[model samples]
Target: MPRISHPRSSSTPLHEGGELALIERIRRRAGGGASTALRLGIGDDCAILRPRAGEDLLVTTDFSLEGRHFRRDWHSPQSIGHRTLARGLSDLAAMGARPMAAFLSLALPPAVARDAGWLEGFLDGLLDLAKQHGVPLAGGDTSESPSEQVLADIILLGSAPRGRALRRSGARVGDLIYCTGTLGGATAEFAQVQDGRGGKTQTASSMNPHLFPQPRLAAGQALLRRKLATACIDTSDGISTDLAHLCEASGVNAEIDAASLPLHPLAQQLTQEAAMAAALHGGEDYELLFTARAATKMPRKLGGVPLTCIGRVVAKKRRAPQVTLIAADGSRSALAAQGWEHLR
Candidate 1:
């Protein structure tokens, strides 16, 4: 079952400084970037981003809603902020795009806005990741929330070589399905946090996979540069769900060797059945799930992330399951889209 945490109480509110003052503070923290792509950033009505010669611009947007995306008590402000931006970055990564700039629109309720500590922590988390990715905070809107919750929307702009960005519909029959890194770490950590077995630390360490998922941007870019993948999609949703997406988009079906799944160390802590379930249905891993030709010789790892061949694309058969998982015992079963679904 999912859990929601209590809201923190604060004596101060963000309204005290007005919107302009808050924007100034964020601008100072975000600082001016050296990226030649961003000719103008915050303080302007709109940001100007210069795409590289012969590059195609890509844009992605996402929403982070309190109680839906996160809980204030369970997730640190830093984690919340980091996740808000990560959601968009992961989308860019899915299509083999390099992040150029980011725009954030934040709406804070009275309770949340009153806490300066929380706000600063959120900015620190967001700005840190932005800096690491060379993505400057460009321009966005800010307003007060009508409800007692925090709402964040981020837009990420990226660029890729013209006519070369990866797509879900490009996969062909006989292509091998590959995924970057281990599976189910985020879902495993979320269970721990919900059970009160995980600490609410501000540090977004690698171990806190649920709180801080690292987007596989480098691997996506490498795939484009090397022509290593015919299709690509990020596993923001679990493999079972995401694989179905790839299959549907490519008008194909797939078969997965269940034993070949690279379960996360965190997920391995669970019972065997639970671990398998988590790996198949877990969401928000932010790893890339891609397809390459069977004849393609792939490196053991791309961008320092392990690549695992877990499945293969097949021709779509009438009345056949979109995805089939083959168990160690030689049993096969349908793999449903059991991961996260909005308004479910």
Candidate 2:
């Protein structure tokens, strides 16, 4: 079992009127109005979606748990809501899909259940992001948790053009590896939050990447449209582990150069070991990692986000390992799959 932790007894209480009343409040806050595709949305037994013509449906679900994913002291209700939904959306982005709708199921703690303001703030964060992405909150379930922690599950539905969804199996030998955005910010954020240095390190300008990650939806869409990537995945788990998954799927090996990693500036402020460790093993970056042909020309930026080439995919010889890490001095070693993992 995961370790248990409690939120400080400080925020608004959830509505005592219970589940049905909570549902209505969330429905209103979600702005689930009738649309042609959604003939029946929140009020229905199940949401009905009239799929877009010639598109493939993509569905992904993600969960956010209290002690496992966040602490109420470290995260605001609004940030928590935004992040939970964002986690599901990031999965869709990996497949180059456009968001269509979302379903949210919440198991709220008693303290939060009795707090109307807390609920409102949470819904506002979730709904606002949904609106921004043109994904309406279609339908969901709600209940008070039997314990002190809150648990949330988000199911996001998206669509991509027929036969165009990106996967981790298409990369081939000699393809160049690419990643969007800097690495290490989320790692730094995690250290500050979990090590009890959050108050000392965090500021309005220096936001935690773990708390506020921008999924690479636009970059994924652009890559799909331009047919630029042979394989794609998001950098949710640390790059070393996630890239290992991609390499295994594609039946290839990878060589990542330590010097080529595009690290967050904050990485420079840390010890050399910490920076490199975070760059390799820290998770929750939520950026894009893709493989493209070596000769294929790529734009310097996608959707105003820099796209940097960091490594290359190679055909694995018999008994060869999946990934190799190249040090700054060009020495090579078998890459360790030591990134973040659940229950680790």
Clashes of each: 2, 8
Q: What TM-score would each prediction reach against the true structure?
A: 0.94, 0.90
CA lDDT, candidate 2, residue 69: 83
Clashes of 2: 8
Model 1 has a clash total of 2
TM-score of 1: 0.94
Compared with the true structure, what per-residue lDDT tens digits does model 2 show for residues 1-344?
Answer: 01112335633334467566777787777665334456557776677789879999999999889888877777777778878888988898888888888888888877888878777877776776676678888888776676799899899988999999999999999999999988988888767766666523221222556766777889999999999999999988889888988988898999998899988876767898899888888878888899999989999999668999999999898867678889999899887777865221
lDDT tens readout by residue for model 1, 23-77: 7777787775567898877776677777889999998889999989999878889
In candidate 1, which residue ranges exceed 4 Å CA deviation? Answer: 1-14, 342-344
Candidate 2 scores a C-alpha RMSD against the true structure in Å of: 5.5
Candidate number with greatest lDDT = 1
